[model samples]
Target: MSDESSNEAPRTVRLDRELVRALAHPMRNRILGLLRVYGPQTATTLAGRLGVNTGATSYHLRQLAEAGLVIEDDSRGNARDRWWKAAHQGTEFDKAELLDQEPELALGFLHGVGQSYAENIFSFIDAVQTMPADWRDASVLSDYFFHLRADQLDAMMQEVLAVLEKYKTADLTAPLPEGAEQVTVQLQAFPRETR
Candidate 1:
């Protein structure tokens, strides 16, 4: 399950049902999010920040590690102070992957992810709202929508994937231009017509 390939590039992994089930828990998802954004940390530290018992956090962390969604950080000073981080930078799952086995479960998981994203988006908006008017004025808003005829659906998907790959590999941590606020790049695509 480790996708660390030497010859090929790191591939986008699709979470299996068991792994998805493990991540369905709010605490586990939060733990993964924290590790991804802030790098490795011990379960005790995560528990303290999340206001939960270390034992509970440790159990969930173990499940994530077993599911191959996280990997232990052996660089930490002590063996007892186990640290963990996300196994992959990104993950993707198509509807077919879930629908074939359990439609309800897949739908539920997707709904949960959508809800979490919606909440995050609103929270970001609220944070920006509290900032100074001048700061808001300096921000930019962009919207792009277009329709193009394509001979094959696979081609369009490949094009979109290429664009995403560019951003995924880009130096996103670089400092922004003066007077410019953070920019949120959101990409969403769906079939315009069903055959």
Candidate 2:
């Protein structure tokens, strides 16, 4: 879902070559995502959650920070135990332009993003059995197929994002109700060439 407040549009940074290169690494992308979703965290804590060593996590965090995707959250920790947080609420990029300009880097970045999406889906599946009844009932993992022109597909996705923005607005305007939990809402819409 979107991350901005109801009063303001989401802050999205366009991907430049430097940022693309920084995020091409799967671990760096994961590190940035974790900081975004869960708030500021120390490298040690992130490493523990990511099943990696602190040194590696720290290195990735530094790379992300260098690209301005993340920043040290000095408010949260001491010098020795620095914390990191996402610099922007979201990111946007022209996929075609990137592909034409920096083919390898663009592909590597997209691959990491796709891998992350798959991991999120799989993690949810693995946890569904043990989730609370209410959450189980609320979750959805479904897809639809439709014949549409490229323009129509783009419009459909925009509408979907608008709805998600409504929910994100609600989140910022009020405190979440009891029992409310952070949920991952993923949207993937693409043409199927083979099928």
Candidate 3:
């Protein structure tokens, strides 16, 4: 699935406190994830996948749209149906800055983000052995401890994202290779808490 919107700038946007607060709900995170990983879809489709009714998905979709986390795709579906997609493929923020400015709100935001990450990580673990050998070998599923300054970590994070972006198929409209599959590349660069 393509991450970038058809008529917008690249699908990457920085988040502010208000936006983070808006995204604190777990359902919002899951809905956004589904959209990002599968391209634009109608609320009914998402509801079916999520095991929820259309009304529940439609309500959350509206809330997400209000927060700029999602946008309506008028090009898709008929007048009777509305399609929704992620407003951005990714989001970023300075943890220190957020905590310094609004600690509680940042925690709330991070909680939702962290919940999503944990879920994905567990899902990956559960499905890793069932994947093809080549894909399993290509998988990146490890964390390492290292001594580094904050700037150094930031630089490394940028390099990793750069590599991922280089190989990304940003536009869903383009035809991809026969073996092409939408893959989620989840990354985490954070200090390990010590007791």
In the order shown, what is each candidate's alpha-carbon RMSD?
5.3, 3.9, 3.6
Clashing pairs in 2: none
Ranking 1 against 2 by lDDT, winner:
2
Q: Which residue pairs collide in model 1, if any? A: none
Q: Is candidate 2 or candidate 3 better by TM-score?
A: 2
Model 3, 33-105: lDDT tens digits are 8887778989999999888999989999999999888999878889799999888887778888889988988
Q: Model 1, 1-195: lDDT tens per residue?
A: 343445322445577787778777778877876776566889898999778999999999999888888888767749568888777655677778777877777777777677666666676677777878886676544445556555555677788879866755332334556775445555545556657
Q: How many pairs collide in each candidate, listed in order?
A: 0, 0, 0
Tell me the deviation in Å of residue 157 in model 2. 1.2
Off by over 4 Å in 3: 1-10, 172-175
Question: Which candidate model has the greater lDDT, 2 or 3?
Answer: 2
**Candidate 2: where is the Cα deviation over 4 Å?**
1-10, 169-176
Query: Please, what is the TM-score per model?
Result: 0.67, 0.89, 0.82
Q: Using lDDT, rank the candidates from best to worst.
A: 2, 3, 1
